[model samples]
Target: MKNFSEIEAMARMHHPDLDARLAAHGHLRTAQEIADIPDDRWLSTMTRCVFQAGFVWKVIEAKWPGFEAAFDGFDPVTVSFYSDDDVARLASDERIVRNGQKILATVHNAGFVADISREHGGFGRFMADWPASDQAGLLELLKKRGSRLSGMTAQYFLRFSGWDAWILSKDVGAALVREGVVDKPPTSKAAIARAQAAITAWSDESGRSQSEISRILALSTG
Candidate 1:
């Protein structure tokens, strides 16, 4: 039930030399900023996060230009139409990572982006319209609708794309447990709900963005 100021005070206690006042987390984008993003860029970032999951990020970074070229700049409409032949081609393509499952996930997630775009005028609009207070709901949508977006990928994509969100990284989870929000990492539906509620309560109590809260908690507990 501690507010952000209290947590920040705790953080300052932990690291006395560093100023503990919450700076805006650099990674999160404002709603207007996120709304201005193109659908293609969204798809591209989503694809990158998907491929980067459980894999070396620098390797993906090194090959991103090839990924962009191979996927035709991640045009959602274009990639949504990729066929079985395209899957086979990408699987053997040296330009990008050769994981078959991840390659197919790109195609599926492209379709997901297209669907959301059509439903909400654009994917950017869909993202922009999502209330930050209900970030867990958006994460659930990503998990149910998108491929290879389970666990941390969706959160990473959100941060990378400038959407404000809390990343339940291992450190963040530990921080949550440390705060008595839950006794362990939130895995089951009930535990996850408890975690989200704890964060939402903190957001209300502190009037801070999820990104700031996440970093503050990480600093204090990690």
Candidate 2:
């Protein structure tokens, strides 16, 4: 398998088209590199994923400000305190998803965020206690948390929000195949090694955010 630096050089050569795809997705950060985003951006991403559960990210991006306003900037303290009337208003907002179920889930998730915050003194702390630094743990957490629009894809989105440290989802590996970035290598250690090399290279130069990487990787791979 190629080392990371060599892979980076190869990927940089192929990065122009990849970069275009990510820009179309509204990605503004580097891949798998979430060290600079602030707390509010993280919360916004979480809330936007709630809206984007079954929808497209571009659509969500277009109405993001509406979401921010409807959810009171995704402030757990403010959103968790939403009244029934507030729910009704949000559910009718045309600029947002306007789906009652998704709207309620966002409210419920806000409260859930509050609960996790109390239990661990902060939601970030709670996420840190998660076992298994892989997609399986993310899947189990989504299932247990009553996430309405969550699945493997959604879990990956959560991981992109800095909720996890790695992208161990099958979809992530499959993305390499879709992009023809890697051969249809066997699903053995060798194949995984090739995929990891591709990911490291892609992450280094594409200037895509993790969520954008997840989206493009999954779509292209599929």
Q: Please, what is the TM-score per model?
A: 0.93, 0.58
Question: Residue 129 error for model 1, in Å?
Answer: 0.5
**Model 1, range 113-165, lDDT digits (tens) per residue?**
99999999899999999988787888889999999887789888988898877
Candidate 2 local lDDT, 58-176, one digit each (tens): 99899888888777788876777889999998878887988888777777777766776777666665555554223344455655774563554455555556553334356656556
Clashes of each: 1, 1
> How does model 1 fare in lDDT?
0.85
Best by lDDT: 1
- Which pairs clash in the backbone of model 2? 178-221
lDDT of each: 0.85, 0.59
* Regions of model 1 farther than 4 Å from truth: 16-27
